[model samples]
Target: MISVGVDVGNKFTKAVVLKDGQVISKSIVLSGFDQKQSANEAYDQAIKEAGISKNDVNYVLATGAGKKEVDFANDVVSEVGAGARGAVYFFPSGRTIIDVGAEDGRASKCDQNGKIVDFAVNEKCAAGAGSFSESMARALEVPLEEIGPLALQSNNVIYMNAQCTVFAESEVVSLIHAKTSKADISKAVHDAIAARIISMARRVGVEKDLVMIGGVGNNVGFLKALGDGLEIEVLVPDKPEYVCAIGAALIAAERN
Candidate 1:
């Protein structure tokens, strides 16, 4: 059986095609101003990559912040539920999941079977999410993709005190004006976010085989900071940002 999953996130839409319990293809695109359009584009792209026609899909499931906007989906799943299932699929031994998306961050404790036990989230602000780093990179006049590598070059760990995105912007500017090294500033920004993420994860109770997912998981510097802050090895899957969509596709397979 072939199944498709769509995840409409705040900043990006992700699609996955699963066949016979394996992910055959996936696609990601900026959400832009039209969520539905982006979802369709992602789904269509994945189908094309898999060399499958739309009619070939047996089921379609949608997940994420904008999941409800995907009118064509057969059903929808909570982002947290999808994330937990997807992460477990990649790391079967994982019991704790840390997902840092564009707009928010989540920490979930799950069973060996990928069932959620408890969870905590930091959604009130962007300070603990990917947007924070993106904004910081912009302030430093560096590409977001380069921020992680630049941070890795830091010989000293500068401390960032701002806990709010708006305030952090000013702090970053001040640091820049003070002639702070970009590498140190980058490390500071990620460290601040890491501290917040670790706190949220701890509330849900951290356990062995911790996994990190979502777009921010692509940031090696952030991952390193998170690992150090939590004092645990962070396991990440390939294309970690697509994990939620992958989970939704897996769910579609199960229902079929």
Candidate 2:
């Protein structure tokens, strides 16, 4: 069966095309003002890459913050469910899942079969999501892609006390005025975000074989901080941002 999945997230929209159980093509596009347009663009790109027409697809599923905006989807799944299913597809041993995107962070405890047992979410807070790192990177005059690697070079442990993104930006400015190294400040930013994620994960009862999937999973500094804070290795699948889309496609195949 050929199935397609479109995930319309806050920052980006992703689409994946799968043939039977294997991924054939995937696409990602910035989610601008119109989520529906973004979703359609991503889906079109994926279909083109896969050399298939919309008529060839057997099912189309949507998931993520803007899932409801996908008017063409045959069905919709919650982010938690899609995330858990995707994580398990990559690592059957993954029982605890953490997904951190542009605007929210979530943790879920799932069984071996990808059935969610418990879950927790940190939403509507920039401080608990990737936007916090983006804001801090901007304040430090560092490129978003370089900030993660820069944080890994710091040996000093600097703590950031501010919990709000607005206050945290000011704190970053203060650190700069105090002649704090950019690396140290970067580390502090990652540590702060990791702390919040760890706290949320704890609420759902963290377990071994933990997996992290989302756009933020690509941030090495944040990944290191999260692992260190949790005292456990966090597994990340290739192209982590597409996991939810892939999961949605898998579900489409299963449902049909």
Candidate 3:
């Protein structure tokens, strides 16, 4: 069966094409003012990469913050549901799933079949999400892609007390004024976000075989901090940002 999944997130839109439950092609694009347009653009890019036509697809599913904006989707799934399903698809033993997106962070505990048992969300603030890192990186005058590696180079244990992104940015500025090294500030930013995410995960009862999915999953610094905070290794699948789209495609295949 050929299925397609489109995830319209806060910062980006992703699409994945699958054949018989295996990923064939995927695309990611910035989510502009028009979410529907971005979704279609991503889907078209994926279909083109797969060398397939829209007519050949069996089903199209949508998931993410702007999922409802995907008017072309045949069905829709919640972000938590898609995250759990995708995580389990990558690691069958994944019972604890953590997804840190651009605007929010979520932790879900699921059964063997990817059915959610309990979940917790840090939705009120961006301090625990990818945008926080971007803001901090900007404050540190470092490139966004370089922040993770920079953080990894530091061994200092500097703590950030701000829970709000605005305050966090100010705190970063203060640290700079204090003559703190950029590496230490970078590490502190990642550590603070990881700590908040871990606290939320604990509310959902974190278990073995923990999986992290989302754009932030690609951040090596955040990954290390998260694993250290939880005292467990965090598993991240290839193209972690596209996990939700893959899950939606899988769901489309299963539903049909």
Specify the highest-lDDT model's number.
2
Shift in Å, residue 65, candidate 1: 0.7
Q: Rate the local accuracy (lDDT) of all candidates.
A: 0.92, 0.95, 0.94
Give TM-scores for every candidate, taking all chains together and pairing residue i with residue i: 0.98, 0.99, 0.98
lDDT of 3 by residue, 177-198 (tens): 9999999999999999999999
**Per-candidate total of colliding backbone pairs:** 0, 0, 0
In TM-score terms, candidate 3 sits at 0.98
Q: What RMSD, rounded to one decimal, does every model reach?
A: 1.0, 0.6, 0.8
Residue 55 lDDT (model 2): 95
* Runs with alpha carbons beyond 4 Å of true place in candidate 2: none
* Candidates, ranked, lDDT: 2, 3, 1
Lowest summed lDDT window (length 10), candidate 3: 120-129
The residue-by-residue lDDT of candidate 2 on 80-181, one tens digit each, is 999999999999999999999999999999999888999999887998799999999999999999999999999789899898999999999999999999
Model 1: per-residue Cα lDDT over 1-256, one tens digit each: 9999899999999999999989999999999989989989998899999999999999999998899888889999988888999999999999999999999899999998788999998777899999999999989999999999999998687888788988998999999999999999999999999999999998999999999999999999899999998899999999899999998898889988
Which 10 consecutive residues of model 1 have the lowest summed lDDT?
A: 154-163
Model 2 lDDT, residue 54, Cα: 95
- Candidate 3: lDDT over CA atoms? 0.94
